[model samples]
Target: MTVVGFRSSIGTWGCAIGLIGLTLCWPAITPVSPAVALADEPAAAETPPDQPENDGSTETDSQETPSTGRTLEDAPTLERQVLTELESAPHWPARALAAIRLERFDCAPTRDRLIEFVQHDPDWRVRANAIRSLAERSIEQGEGWFEEEAEPRVIRTALRYGYEVDAGRVHRGVRFLLRSNRLDERLLGAEIAAASGKDDLVADATDTVRSVILRMDRAQAGLLSPRLSAMTGVRGLFSRQDWMRWFRENGRRVELAETRRDPPNPHPPPAGERSFLAELNVDAFARFESYVQQWPELRIDLVFALDCTGSMTPVFSRTQSIISDTMLFLQDITESPRFGLVAFRDVDQEFVTRPFRLTQDAEEIMLQTWLQEAVHGGRQSESVLAALHDSYAMSWREHVERLVILIGDGPPHRGEGGACIRLAERARTRGGIRTQVVEPINAPVRDFKEIAEAGGGRLWTLDDYVLILAELLGLERSDDIDQAFMAFIRHYTELLR
Candidate 1:
């Protein structure tokens, strides 16, 4: 598939290659411009020959920078070179690449430059990259960016990175995207609503989805129906009147369901107490049951590969609960769904990878115990490749659907020779194991996305995982899954490719 187009001529692949080349050539490049050196040469004439050239920023001034203590002049040579590219690169792709590279550096100048690109870059791709860089640094511009940004791609980038959303901005952005003539943009609007997890916008988002489905042809509507199902949390409602009637009767219940699961709810009930499917009114529940009854009984084997490292400590409990809830929900829907788990940390840890074979034990006592016993003290980068490789050793069922959901926050350590990606490819080709990633918004996502793509699955954020899973598992036929995948690729081309 082609990369999504920005307002520039250069394709994404070309930009990626150019950026890689620039990184490789960084060390040999001159750090300072000759003009700046010439201007400072007279003042520094009295300095020792071995002394570094001073850029005139005081030490006190450096202390006040955002995250890093060094000014651009004192920053490492590689960072300085990337900063120069960001400032003076002629092409939009070069600037975009520079913005992405700058994410690793957290100094005042880098922050200022990224903010400038977010505000004034001519190309949307550059702005999107800059937005992601800022988000990675934990620098949030709040709802103001959402209110001011005109491009859906830019807004979606912010949304995907955990930017705080309020009622006012969501209402405005949802209305703008939903009202667009382009089907992709409209679908993105529904996506934005779903990602936002704002119960208040449910009515408007549901109404818009219903209206769009009614107007589009069957094929196009087939692509959009999942969004409606995701938003309303009820499947099998086809006609506009059916959706309207359901919403009128149970709209408040949908909002309440969202409230229960939304991340902001500090006191979320335990996994056993919450069930989105069970909470639906009797009629909606009956409809969903009827919808699933047509499908032939199928056997499925699932595995969860979780990263138990220091970085994941903050959200570990919540993540575990979500996975537990997911298992319960899947059990409710499917006839036979067996689950396994592989908890992993870095090589330096006591254990690199701990595996639990697939089992039909619905009690899930062993899985839950392992999940709770999983320790979290490794380095930032975990043994993801080891976990993936070990997952293949599981006794997967033959001629049945197999899935592996990798939940993590960091990439694999260096010098793994891309073994993790190769495992993903082999899983799809020989083992029939589809891989999906559930990643935190602030985590480095490119590698996880690659694994998912190789294993023929989609990468989902924690906030959107439930909805995406609902859509993915609810599909009755292969063609419907293909259409859903196409819609996903269309909306997320910038991130996926």
Candidate 2:
């Protein structure tokens, strides 16, 4: 809860590169002090093969001793003093050793000293360095203090020190600027400003000021990342305000309108729709999950082929649970597949979810939060097939098994749906992908059945749609999953054998 930091020895820009700034406060009794930097691209570095990569994986060497140990436990001296500097450690490119070292030693006094420097230090770079220190230390609890902002520590540090490169901070500040109508006020103390009086952004984003302003306007106009907003139901694509408030006032109203608008289907399914649930047990799904779990020599991946044509409006309404639910299913699975979602319509396409290598649990909560606040979509060609092809072609990571999950009303617009099935078949034949189709019954299944068969994937009707989704993504099957999974697994086993 303590928001603290100190400048590092490196200069301001150095803080941006190696990102070594804050030395957050901890309980250790003693203290020391520091100062600012920038430098060449972080020097290519190496650590013991067991050590972490430059990208911070070193924080996870699995060698990290959990802090559950009692406070009295002995602490290891930081192997070396000069090398202890993370932002400027010259020899090793400052591996996780530096960050890990900070974790063990009580840096509270150092953190306090950093805070003091930021508040009083004349050099904006020095203040920037102070925040860098805090950013490095924010993960003390593993669960980030990152509220909706994701990095209050770093943003405050960036604001204090005058660097603005992080996409998050840039967007956050833009949102604030829009809401406050006080761009100049927020720009006060804006150290990173250029002669144009606009804040100097990160090198990667040097040209986005005008663009960002436009984005802000679009967000205000409710037109940013319709795909993301639709999937997450998170209004204000980039609208900046106390979102929780926006969520309460506007979110509640939208939700109420939605509920009222979509009266319950007069034809709810009978309670006894599915009685003998043979697929509920793992015996039925051993090969499916086990194969997926052990698929990769090292990793596996998942992709969601979401639909977003105008016809899908009602589907989105009833299917707000799709994204959140699928994400949770990924969490329940033993194999943590890198996940991404691709929502497509011909004229307009939204990657809304990009493919990334990460465990399902890591993404599930955020995906759920995203879905709860996301918006519905726009109109376009029912291009499920084209979206899959392009997404696969564009993906760079080599995954073990590419699971393309198609979430749409069964089939596509007339003469347009076969591309998806063909793409799935191609992925399976050459790339070892395991394709599955979670099609809805809202549209005709006439074309969907052929599509599913062609792709060698399973097809399910949207009865207890959410439950079907659960099993397809390996979630806990409620009812439909039990029925549908059995059929799918059996077919897969028969075909593979």
Note the Cα lDDT for every prediction shown: 0.55, 0.37
Model 2 Cα lDDT, one tens digit per residue, 1-497: 11122111222222432332322221121011121111123345556787654442222133232233212123323323322343242222122122222322223433344444334443333333444443333312111111222222233344332233444434434333223222221221121222112333332122322232233321222212222232234543333332334445653332210100111122322322311221123343332333233222334466666665556655553344444434433333324545665655544344433333333443343332233322344443355666566556535356445566666653454666666667667777776666666666454554566666666666765454444443344545435435544443332221111
Global Cα lDDT for candidate 1: 0.55
Error of 1 at 320 (Å): 0.4
Model 1 lDDT per residue over 1-497, tens place: 11121111211212322211110111111110000000001122355698885443323233333543324556556555445644575555446545654555546776677777876787665787777666655564532344335455455556666665445555665665566564545656665665565665555555566565545542233223444554556766533344456657864334311311212212222222322321233343333333333223546788888888777766665566456545644553355778888888877777888887788663342234223433556454678899898777799978767888898888877755277888899989988888888886456554788888898887888776655454545543344333333332232233311
The C-alpha stretches of model 2 lying farther than 4 A from their native spots are: 1-300, 348-381, 394-401, 410-418, 464-497
Clashes of each: 0, 30
RMSD of 1: 23.3
Stretches > 4 Å off in candidate 1: 1-291, 294-296, 365-378, 471-497
